[model samples]
Target chain A: MTPKVSRFLRDAAPATPCLVVDVDRVAENYGRLKAAMPLARIYYAVKANPAAPILGRLVDMQSCFDAASLEEVRLCLDAGARPEDISFGNTVKKESAIQAAYAAGVRMFAFDSEPELRKLARSAPGAKVYCRILVGNVGAEWPLSKKFGCEVEMARDLMVMARDLGLDPYGISFHVGSQQTRTAAYEAAIARVAMLFTDLKDAGINLRMANLGGGYPVRYRAEVPEIDAFGAAIMGAMVEHFGNALPEILIEPGRFIVGDAGVLSAEVVLVSRKEQDDPVRWVYLDIGRFGGLAETEGEAIKYAFRTPHDGGAEGPVTIAGPTCDSTDTLYEKSNYRLPLALDCGDRVELLSTGAYVTTYASQGFNGFAPLAEHYI
Target chain B: MTPKVSRFLRDAAPATPCLVVDVDRVAENYGRLKAAMPLARIYYAVKANPAAPILGRLVDMQSCFDAASLEEVRLCLDAGARPEDISFGNTVKKESAIQAAYAAGVRMFAFDSEPELRKLARSAPGAKVYCRILVGNVGAEWPLSKKFGCEVEMARDLMVMARDLGLDPYGISFHVGSQQTRTAAYEAAIARVAMLFTDLKDAGINLRMANLGGGYPVRYRAEVPEIDAFGAAIMGAMVEHFGNALPEILIEPGRFIVGDAGVLSAEVVLVSRKEQDDPVRWVYLDIGRFGGLAETEGEAIKYAFRTPHDGGAEGPVTIAGPTCDSTDTLYEKSNYRLPLALDCGDRVELLSTGAYVTTYASQGFNGFAPLAEHYI
Candidate 1:
């Protein structure tokens, strides 16, 4: 067991399994992305972390909002994002959801099929449409291309149908995939969308925007392409294909906006020996599946068990959570040093959990309390 | 794409991401276990799905609640579980938490340490203690024995300390591990606990219960053991080892109680081609890292993706959720078939999601909503 330890942020008091967003880091991330995509309008994906305070700050940063559901739109709209400044990007939407989006004043939406276009025409009269396409992925194993994006043939049909309905289907959009490891995917995707743009223009539709759907990969475990270099490659492709005819650019980067800005802080509860012939030990933390890194089951990143403090680093101890469930383990092993002895009430901080952490918390146990926000 | 279809208990109405438990299935599950272990006292591990109504139902099943925290104790109390019926099973606990558990009227608690004994004595002096033992795991890659249970040698010492403190240390407890695949582990654990009974008696401490702990596996996939048979083996071991001296038995069963009873119904929003040169497709559902399934990164469990209305099942599709993050995928690849083509707004049900589903959901895009509870 590691000895008694403390976290710098919780030296005063501790809140277990809560997310703390470093507001300064978030602003810096937004600033860096905004600077690189000077010609393209950036929209923060609210699905990452939609805290009202975070939403308000992003709005202040002049970033538009991207929502996936009616409830998401409502939350962003309530947080004071202009209705038109919001983009309802979920392609497979309900009729009532489409009508609600229309009533909520969402002007721009993405469509991946002829049925989607037809439904939009019936529900929202003359909504501006962007034909979302399944431009072949570069190398990332993203599921979006198969799940939501329309094929090239279907994209053409949807675009023509939008024109027939007298709706200004003024854009071409394709998300390469999230956490894209290579920049070539974006380049290839942009080239494909460019071809679609030319085809749409030949059909007498004046496109106004080229939406490079957001899947700007954050370098989670490994190095990814730089935003500037990747953007430059895509922009160069847009200029080569459409020249002056290329529309204004829009990108919907979700994780790139806020992923690294948040951290989940938990406390150590007990340190005990593992079962069997193995000589391993364990340090139980307060945060488990209910915390931000819940997707890792009990363990998220390999380094999730990596503790920052050397003094608190104890012997090789597997970490578990406070949940009574058998699967409530946090780490199978630890690489970092832990305190030689840790009693109850010690803290462990889970790093780099800002993007999808707090928003995915289950409120089923003890009324869900929002993580306390501290802006520095 | 399979033609639009439907399935049992779901309609055209969109089902939310997290799994919904059939109250009937839950009641039946409890009834089956009760009938099998007629002499054993079941302690429902509330960490699986600690909603108030779920706890209330368990109370009616006559099962006591096993809580890890003071808050969980309060939750069981709020759901009308008598304090005496609540067991604080967390080995390493806070002083305030101990007081809270005591105040909440919990009488039985698990003790893991020499220091913890003094703390529990100062806070919950009247509470009965269960000396948790580190009886090495049966056959698990990772076990809870690493984090909570006391060493076998320490268990003897702690029992002696409990006696010196004038506290009625009721029994010894040990959890094999979650999703434990070995039945022999239970037999071995019972043998160790039986041995400990003699050790504690030699120390002049009379104990009356043996909590073999809860790591009873659930059939998340087709490969798990039958619950009925496993129950028989465990009971047989208890009778064999303890003979007439078998203390009142207690077991904490978490996922095994509710995992199979729940299904997460989601909407299939988009289906597109995987961009690779090879022909592959992606089926995106409206679920993600924080939605219905919480531990995609840990263990790989097959999700039975079915469309509502009997949509004819299609090719092997990789299923993903709507979160813009790359890691938000649900199933890497599946051989699922539906009745018809799934269009926009078509529903997909992810089965066997009852255990760690909403308990880990964070309201990322929209806030968490309550699940519907229907009586059998």
Candidate 2:
């Protein structure tokens, strides 16, 4: 076991199936990002974890926030973040939420559609708004897929419309995608943004900022580049494309900052073989899809798991969450392997689960409580 | 618009993105099931909704419950259901949950593995237990796969082991699958149970009950056979296979009991074409997968939608929930069509959504609250 897991097991272990977030790791991650991208302002995405302690740690680091909803904005505000330091990042929002965010002193918001722009005009007039442009999500694990951003032409129209509606078209934003692994994807998305900036300038809309929305990949089972590599690429791209006219760079990093900070200690509920001769062992854990870890959707994102007998002879294993729902199975087709001696009550630590797990947990599905979160 | 939609709009138009359940329809559904299957005991699956009002209505009708957890048992008990009338239906359960259920006077439980059987033997000693046999789920919309049930030989061993552990091996149970459409699936599963019963009897264990676990189909976009057809098929299979020595029949229906009784009123958040010439309109609703309606997993279950302009010329539309998550898109690939005139603020009612929507909702993802549920 790693020292972090050992410390968690010794000092702060809650009941099994609980998320234990190490605040120290979060601070290290924040420091790394800040050191790498001194020119870029970090707006920590609150939707990733929304844990108050994590937010407070970011607040202590003098970090800004990218809030998705009124509740997230409130969470950041409660965590001591100034209103000017937070950006309402979700483009599609309820009118009431926009009003509530505006009322709470938030001035920066993101919008993509005319309807949302209209809603912003009504509720958040003169707010510094950013139009999210659709850049294809080719290399990202969690693709946004036309959900948030609009086409560049539509974005141009929306930017002009924002100005006409009396909202400041302050910047342009685009998500390369969540858990974006390829640095080339950033280069491509930045190129698209650069082209858009030129087009908007020709249209008499001088964008003041460029929000490089979150998609900074974190290492799980696969290797990822250091935060410095990403910062260098982004910085190099801005210099090559904009030269002396570089827009103020802002980033909304969700998974990159918190992903490695959390560890989920889950206990094996049962260990059984389907058939006597079957080689595969099915290890059911106390936590599953509904128990937070919804990111295991389609079993696409493979999390690094640490068992006590990690170096022992390994055998094929199917991991499942402790729920009646069949879709709660975490690894069946993924060729997941674990120690053969692992039995019921054996604890396993899921690494890099700090982001997206707790916030996406369903409320008491099949009588299973949401995954308990504990900050260390 | 359908008459139901018109009535809902005219009489009880709730806030957008709310679940409205018709108690009268629930009663009618219960009556229909009772009328069709007079011999089988109706154990309403609490995991389906677990709404207090729905449970109260079931209690008034003297319906038994198939609780998945201790909380579900408590919900039923709070709804005035007798402990003797409730069965702990989930096979994989926490030891504490089993103890809690036993303490709450629930004697009937289900198990499929030796580990679980051992847990039950310790916590719920002398309780009436059933071994779930793996039945193929070829025709199920939501296939259970291998998440549940054991093979016949392992089940036989587990049954004998249950008796050895001093727990009553009360019965054999198998689920054809959830949302099973083919009547032959039930017939085949019942035949398998019959052979198991004969084998168990030969082993000197007299099984006292046969639980044809819930998979009763409900009308969505497709036509489904009435409850009577399923009842007739089950009865015929039992009679044909077991003759006069039939065990007591029990069914735990979740979706069938509640699916048709609920309607979801979701307002259009936006209607937009990604490309100006694109033919398909993307209709965003205030509700999405996290908002409930997670049954739309894989787009396998298609819900019938009724717009105010239902009879107007229709165009292919992509349905999405009002969340920033890309996976929240409901029907992008399912040939879902809506009225071309459907615009922002236009209300659309999702029919037959009563059973699994409310209880499965995420706590709050992307700042959106859980789908508000109202019973009329």
Candidate 3:
């Protein structure tokens, strides 16, 4: 945990099952990322954690935003962001959302299909549009594959169609997937985008931007390559493919900017075993999958935990949330182990949970209050 | 869809991506369950969908409630349910919640571990307590295994310990699983509970209740055993084991009581394909896994769809929610097919979604509003 967050927990002692975020850590992460890639403009993906404090800090950093919905665009605006600094990033958007966002003075938008392109043409007239192309999600824990971006041929035609339909064909975008590990994945995706840029140029549409859609990794029970490595790989590929005439580069990072900035403090509600001699104890926490640990589904995004009994002898454990549903069990097959001294009512902190935790909480599943959040 | 909901939709034309529940269908389902199991008391599982309209109607039907949290206990009370008729059924609970529920005059509680049982004994003095036993969840589409319940021997000992702690050792409870498809699953669980009942009786605890927890099926995309068949199998097993000395049989049903009573109406946001020659279309809906169809995780609950052009030519489709996260993709490997004519802005209905949909909605992921709800 960050010293600021730990200090807050020691003094405030908030109620069980709450998220405590160190705001300064967010600024530090942003600074480090900027140092890693000096030329690339950062667009903070607001869908990760749209808390006002975090957004306000990013606004002070002069960072632009990538909004997944119109409401997110308004959140950026509400946080003192200029309208020109936001992009409507999701390809699948309602026409009304497009109209509202356009009316709000956000000019940049994303589209992968002809229908979405048409919606943008009708609602967001004269807006800058980017075509997303499909890419392989190699070595990603959470792959963002076929649910999104279209094929290269379709994207090539769409950018040309965008120019003909009174829109600015501004860029090409691709994501190697969320929680992407290997830096080579980004290089491969960039090569694909470069090929698309060449094809679109031949089709009479010279796309001037390259959006390296975010898949940056965070430390979560495993070692990942440093951000400097990704920065080096991206710059190397740009020179190799674009002959030093690199397009205006944009990076939409969410997890890397704020993942390690927060910790989820939850209490052990109960500790039990199925049998007297069973080796694995089921550690039930007040916070669960429905309680905002939604990323723990599939036991992917494994989170490192801190307990009061750290450094003590530990045993095999099946961690679970207090919810009655079997799927609420967080880590059964992931070889999770907990301190044997742990018991009910002991406070435990799930580390590096700043991103994608708060917003995914159910409104009130099983009548448990929505997870409480505190920004330091 | 129920004629009541469909007629309401036709007349009212409520906004898309909302739920339309027929309160009358809840009453009819309650009536059928009561008729099928005349000897047992029905405790509506409030965690399924805690909308006030559904709870108030179930209260008017003289239905008892199984609450998973203390807030749910208050909800039942607000809906006119007597404290004496309600049971706090979740195995994992905080001590403060136990104290509050006991102060609210709730007398029946459930526990599976010594820690939770001790908390209940201290907080809800002299309350009737039941121990949950681990049971196989074979043949269940959504299994409730290895999470909440304890070993049978452990349950027998806990019941004896309850009597020693000055609490009433009331009963034994087990859930076969949610969306249970086989009658034999219930029979197998009952056989386990019957053995525990016999062991507790031998220890002079005189366990008088057999809490056959809810696992009754709701027909989604596939045919499930009739409710009448479940009633026959349960009663037949009770007779075979107890031999005219059947204990107070109590059934806690949630999904079966309400799953088929509501339909989720959502609008198609976008429809596109990865490649020009790819036969499978990706249908993006305004409502998705985070929106409330959380049962779609792992494609466990296959919801049947009703569209405007159901009779048209059908083709394979990959259905997904309109979120940037790839995990929001719902059905890809399940062979989901839709009308070839389906396109953006078309309305579709997901059937048998009344039970668990509303409570599972994320507060607001990606700046989208929580799923809207309506009752008639």
Candidate 4:
């Protein structure tokens, strides 16, 4: 078990099936990111956790925010973040939300399509808008498909359209993808952004800022390169591509800033064998896929489990959530193993579960309340 | 478009991404079930959709409730359902929840394992308990896998254990699976239950009730047999297996009771082609996996979509939720087609969505509100 989790388990004594976020660890993760990319301004992605305390901590640290909606902008503002420090990162947005965010003083927004640009033009005139260009999301654990960004030609046209619509064609942005691990992915995306910047300039729209959208990875079950390594690769690519004309760099990181700082302490609800001779023990917990662990999408993201009896004999186990729903099974095909001695009422701490949990929780599915969150 | 959806769209100009439930249709579906299965007591599965209005309507129809948690028990009770009329159907439950349900005057419960039996014995002594036996879930649209039910041998032992622990082993139950279309699956499950009933009787335990757990299929993309067809099959099997000594029959139907009674009216947020040569138009809706409609798991359950321009030229399209997450894509691989003329702000109503859409909603992922439900 990591010392962070051990300390949390010892000190917090949190209710079962609750998330315990360590604000100290969050500060440390922030420090690490700042040290890695000193020149780049950090915009904390609010979608990852959106817990009030986490947002408050980030605001206290003077961190800018990447707000996806008007509600998110309100959350950051409530947490003491200035509207000028918030960027509406979602390219596809409701016109009402655009007007609301603009009314609340948010000036930076992202758009990838002409319709979205038109909505922005009507709702928030003269706002600093960025065009997201599509790039390969190779080697990312959660590779974002073609959902947000547009092609380079379309992005160039969109930038010109933004200028024509009386909006600030302020920047170019591209997401390598969420939980991205490869340094080359950054190099390729930065190169694409450089190409887009030159093309937009040729179209008489000189962008002033480049938003390197969030994709920075966090260490889960697998080993990820150090934060410094990602910084070095990004800095090297920016210098190689843009030389003296590098736009002001900005990063919107979600997981890397908060993934490691949180730990989930869920209780073992039941440990039984469906068949008497079955080798794998089914370990059911109070929390499941709907209870904030949706990131276990297809069991692709394996969370490290720690039990009180960690030193005991280990045996193969299929972990499941407590819901009656069949899809709530956490890890069955992954050959997950746990201490043989684990039983009902025993606590199992899932590590690195800080990000993408709370916000994904269902509203009392099967009569069970949403996962409780606690910050220490 | 279905007449129900058209009427709803015409009368209720509800906000985008809202669920419109037809209570009259709910009454009709309930009446159909009653006419089909006259002998079986209807225990409305509250997990399908725990909306207050639906529960109140069910309560007025004199429907028994299959509550999965204490909160559900409370919901049913609040909706005017007698505590005696509610069954705690979820086998895996927290001891505190069991205690709360018992204290709330619930005497009927279900158990599958020894640990659970012990918990029930302590929290709900003398309660009417049913042992769920594992059965094949073939030909089920939503096969439950092994998340619920125990093998026959283990269930037999657990029943005897329940008797020893001062809990009443009052019945045997088995779910063929949710959305079960095959009549043979019910026959096979009933035969196994009959054998268990005889075995328990010989062991000096007279099981007085039999629960044919919820698995009734709903018509979505394909046609389903009428409620009478399922009732006839179940009645024929019960009479064939148990002869004249039939126990009190109980059923917990969730989707079948409410599935067809509701329509989801989601607005088109965006309709764009991701790539230049891509023929598939990506249609984004305000509601996605997080905003309910999680039943689209693995793209297994295909929901029928209807637009205002249903008679217009149809084109291949991929449906997606409005969340920033890539996994929120709903129907990329499902060969979904929509009206080619559909654009942003146009409404597309998802049929047969009343049962599983509302309660399964995530709590505002990506800063989007949960899907609103309006009863008409």
Q: Which residues of candidate 2, in runs, are more than 4 Å off?
A: A1-8, B1-13
lDDT string, candidate 4, B64-124, tens digits = 9998778899999999999999999988888888988999999999878778889999989
Clashes of each: 54, 0, 0, 0
lDDT of 1 by residue, A1-376 (tens): 1112223364645466566666656777888888877888887777777777778888888889888777778888888899999988777566677799889899887777666677788887788888887766666534343556766767876788897886778788888765566767777777788777777779876778888877676655456688888777777877877787768888888778777676666777665553334456566666665544454542434333334455554566666656554465656643534666655666666655666656555555433344554433
Which pairs in model 4 have colliding backbones? none
Tens digit per residue, CA lDDT, model 2, B1-376: 2355447756877787888888777878889998898999999988988988999999999999999878899999999999999999887777888898899899999888888899998999899999888888888898887888888889888888899999999999888889998878888888889888889889999999999988999989999887898899889998999898979999989899889888888888788776657798888889888888788879988999988898999999889988778888899888999998998778888988898888678888877777888877
RMSD (CA, angstroms), candidate 1:
5.8
Candidate order (lDDT): 3, 4, 2, 1
Instruction: Find the 10 residues in a row with the least total lDDT in model 2 chain B.
Output: B1-10
Q: Per-residue lDDT of A1-376 in model 3, one digit per residue for the tens? A: 9999999999999997999999999999999999999999999999999999999999999999999999999999999999999999999999999999999999999999999999999998899999888988988988875988999988888888899999999999989999999888888888888998888777878889999999899999999989998888888888888987799999999999999999999999999998889999999999999999999998889999999999999999999998878899899999988999999999999999999999999998899888999998
Docking quality (DockQ) for each candidate: 0.30, 0.64, 0.87, 0.66
The best candidate in terms of DockQ: 3
Candidate by candidate, in order, the iRMS in Å equals 4.7, 1.4, 0.9, 1.4
Q: Counting only residues 3 or more apart in sequence or on different chains, how many pairs clash (N, Cα, C under 3 Å) in candidate 1?
A: 54
DockQ of 4: 0.66
What's the distance in Å from true for residue A239, model 1?
4.9
Best by lDDT: 3
What clash count does candidate 4 reach?
Answer: 0
Give residue B15's lDDT in candidate 2 (0 to 100): 83
Candidate No. with top TM-score: 3
State every prediction's TM-score relative to the real structure: 0.80, 0.96, 0.99, 0.95
